[model samples]
Target chain A: MKLRRIEGDLWEIPREGRMRVPGRVYSVGPPAPDDPALQQVANVAHLPGILRFSLAMPDIHWGYGFPIGGVAAMDAEHGAVSPGGVGYDINCGVRVLTTALEAEDVRPRLHAVTAQLYRDIPTGVGAKSAIPRLSDDALDEVLAGGARWAVRRGFAAASDDAERCEEGGRLSGADPSAVSARARTRGADQLGTLGSGNHFLEVDRIAEVYDPVVAEAFGLVPGRVAIQIHTGSRGLGYQVCDEFVAEIAARRGEFGEDYATLPDPQLAAAPIASALGQRYLGAMQAAANFAWANRQVMTGLAVRALLHALAISERELGARVLYDVCHNVAKLEEHAVDGVVRRVLVHRKGATRCFGPGDPRVPAPYRAAGQPVLIPGDMGRYSYVLAGTARAMADTFGSSCHGAGRLMSRGEALRRGRGRSIARELAARGIEVIARGKKTLAEEMSEAYKDVAQVVAVMDGAGISRLVARLEPMGVIKG
Target chain B: MRLSLPQPYEDLGHTADVGVRTRGATAEEALARLVLAFAALAAGGAAVAAEREERVAVEGGPGLAGSAVALLRELLYRLATEALVPAACEVLRVDAAGTEAVVAFGRRDPVLHAEGADLKAVTWHAARLEREGAGWVAQAVFDI
Candidate 1:
């Protein structure tokens, strides 16, 4: 696949080989000509009814069907919605929170706080949730209500978290009935649990402020301690996605167009108007709800752990949500296609929605500053806080890269990590780390990912999203 | 789960996930090795137990590759929902419509085992199964 530089960090793969539209990628440095991620971007262009370009964010990396950090919008009336596009981890996302404690406060007792978090918030394989197992009826409510359900059940640190979350943490059209018993069984006792492999809970400190106005709006202040949480819908989301992908694979033609024409089998999809598409949408939304509730519950647990470890009153801690955004999801939103604004289903796999300033969808308080976009980097590097921009709304379907994409495969990381203590290295850098798996720290070390600064630079250079603040992890926990 | 093992499978690397390439004397043999491969990877190098034994049956799509995927998904479901990992998998039947096998199981012991990659899903990305000479070979990837 050949790429033509379109100016700045933007590049294009012109329409070719059954493509419905051209493919666009935003990156300072494009991947190799034969990179599978570039081909996946090109493949997404071949799907039925894809509009404009099948876009790839700067942090794009190869994934099953859609490239991670890939985005594509399809015509609501004619396009197909692929389950692989939403990804297996439905609503796999990150949330940034502000705390009243200063950097000095956390640094002195980072070990204690980190230990408390590890104890209170379960991590790793088969680590049951800190929250008690839910009954079927309770699980149904969780499937239906999302973070709002968690807040009502007293699981969120802030009651208004739903208002500050993407889709207010509860997407409409979620039908618990669409969820399978197998899926329910898988999710039964898994809520609020952090599973292994890149899932983490970190304690951060505001290291630098870029857009002071927006940073202040989101309550970020230099030297103030903050927290970042990353996880997803757990087994429930995985099972639903597995069932649907297989469902589409088995009945390719029944969903309208012949999915046999897809560039990859994992790209199997259904028309939005098809019965199977609606069924998948319903189930996906339900799984997404479960993920939201999962995150919210974890938030409550983190706050509790901090309160106990720091020995501070809740009032003194002042932990509040900065923002929460889902990276993998499909949403019906209105975005301009050739200067005409109409509803389209945006498939954001390994991407985030960054609605620009003044968008009514943004929370009222931060509407002037745009949505807070959290970009958590590798454990030893810097994470960034960016804000949505009108430029992003106009050019990229209001989407941005989710993180510093992997630069090395897990196998390669493990090979390089042989006989080295990643934990000790991080400790040498003044960052504390813990994990249930011995090799996780190595596979997820800073060398495994592209420098986040470069990843965020592409977007900022292109005016997609502006940098707001930089966060440095003082302590980390991983599954 | 612990398996009495002899297998041919190598790690296949991707930018974001992990995969396997397995070879066997027959399609069923290849598929059985694939099942054990999932078990071993899910265990993340932890020793598996043979706490229970059961026959698992699955209705796949219209081909051998489809059945391979179906078999993988069933194992993942068992791991995810029941915390049941496979100690051994003996393929009893394999055809265009489905596959059946008897599997030795163990409760996934978090206390005794290192927490492994909670594989999100088994993807059809580059999933391949074909007859190679007198034997068969299969390949598949998992979302971590």
Candidate 2:
């Protein structure tokens, strides 16, 4: 499929046949050669009841199930949802924590903070959380309450956290019955944990403020310190994917002979109206809620760790959730198509929601300010905070890049790290680092990614999101 | 093929870290044996000892972090394709950030002690390898 350049940062893949919509790609230049992301956009176009153009964010990459940064909206009435669309790590997302402490105030405690975070937060693959295991009934509450569940359980404070989350941290229609027994078993003890690979807890300083009004609204002051927690549902989400993929594989032939031609087997799916589709959606939403709750609990744990290390009270620390948003998810949203408002299931894998100003889905406090867009860069580089724009609603379905996309494989990072002491190296740069595995540290080395600056620039140029603040890393804890 | 007790890794899923090396009459012959070791894990029992030529290409970071994952994935790919896992792998050419290698299989293949499932990916968790004395020590995490 040839991608025809449309404008400054947009490309279009014409709807050839059997496609409900054409495909639109957002990028800076021609996509990287041999990029399969375009193919994913085309595949999404073929899904039943798709509206407008199947969208791909600027940070698009080849992914197993859905192309990373892929988004497609399927009409709620005529469309179908696919588990491949939401990805294995359901609701994998990022959360930023603001602090009253300045960079200088925390400089001496950076090492202690990193160590404390690592010890307090469960990390690494299969790492269990310190929180108690949930019973079947309690798990049901988590599905419905999300961050609210944590707050009620004393994991997080409702006063401090309830307003800063998308959907107030709890999405509606999360039915625990939709979750499989295997998923529950796997997630039973994984709450309040930061699982491995790309998930991290980083200490950062507000480096630059681009919009003082928005920065002040977000409680972000230049040189003020903050923490970023990046994680998701962990093993539980994996279990859901594992269960659904097998279920889909068992019934792929039922989708008819044409299903075999699917560009990628990972895209195997059932019709949105099918029983399988409903089951997958229910489970996925439950898992997504689990992830939201997981991050909230982890945030609370970090706050406690900070208070202990600094010998300060919660009020003194002034730690609060700036904003929490999930990048990997499939959501039911209403978008206008050809002048008609239609409910569509939008799948965003490795893409963050950037709802424009005045969008009702955006919380009331931020109605005029627009939704916050948090884009975390590499540890050695910088991360950014942006706001949604009206153009995002008119063009790209209110979505933006997730992070500095990976440029090198993990094997490459370790190979490059041969004799280097990554820990010592970061410490010398005024950053503290701690991890469960050296190889993970190496594979995730700052050099293994595209400069997030370039990635964010494309989104900004494309008018999907607007820059608000830039943050510099002071310490990091990796699983 | 004989099984060995490897150390448990903190992050690797259901994996064993074993020290493996191969030597033959020549360097090329020895390298071929190493590939065999890797193939043995994926390939099930099949009679008739035969050799076939294969090519492996890896790019980006060359050391254990970057190359090991691709190398392992390639080895698994072959096993998935041939339905016969190599018993051992021989490193033919190991440039700092890259590697070239061959594999060897067992003579009389027995029922393989593995399952019929795709090994989706190899992760960076606990992936490490160090040159100790004359040989190399390494570890990796796989998404099974």
| Top candidate, metric lDDT | 1
Residues A158-239 of candidate 2: C-alpha lDDT, one tens digit per residue: 3758668987887787778978776787788889988767889999999999999988887889999989999888777766
Highest TM-score model number:
1
Each candidate: what lDDT?
A: 0.88, 0.72
Backbone clashes in candidate 2 total 37
Task: Report per-candidate DockQ.
Answer: 0.74, 0.04
Regions of candidate 1 where Cα sits further than 4 Å from its true position? A256-258, B1-3
- iRMS for all predictions? 1.5, 12.9
Superposed Cα deviation of residue B96, candidate 1 (Å): 2.1
The complex in candidate 2 yields a DockQ of 0.04
Compared with the true structure, what per-residue lDDT tens digits does model 1 show for residues B1-144? 223443557888898999888878888778888887877777766678788889889998647888888888888877877778787888988887999998988877766646457776899888877798888988889888
Q: Give me the displacement of residue A155 in model 1, in angstroms.
A: 2.1
The deviation in Å at residue B115 for candidate 1 is 5.6
- Candidate 2 Cα outliers beyond 4 Å, as residue runs: A17-20, A157-160, A256-260, B1-144
Tens-place lDDT per residue, model 1, A1-479, is 89999998799998887888898998748658888899999998988879888999999989989999999999989899999999999999998889999989678899999999999999987567578788999999999999999989787667798888988998898988889999888888888888888889999989999988888899999999999999999988988999999998888867554466788889989898898999999999999999999999999999999999999998899999888999999999999888899889999999999999999999998999998888989999889999999999999999999999998999899999999999999999999999987778888999999999999999999999999999999999999
Q: Cα miss at A146, model 1 (Å)?
A: 1.0
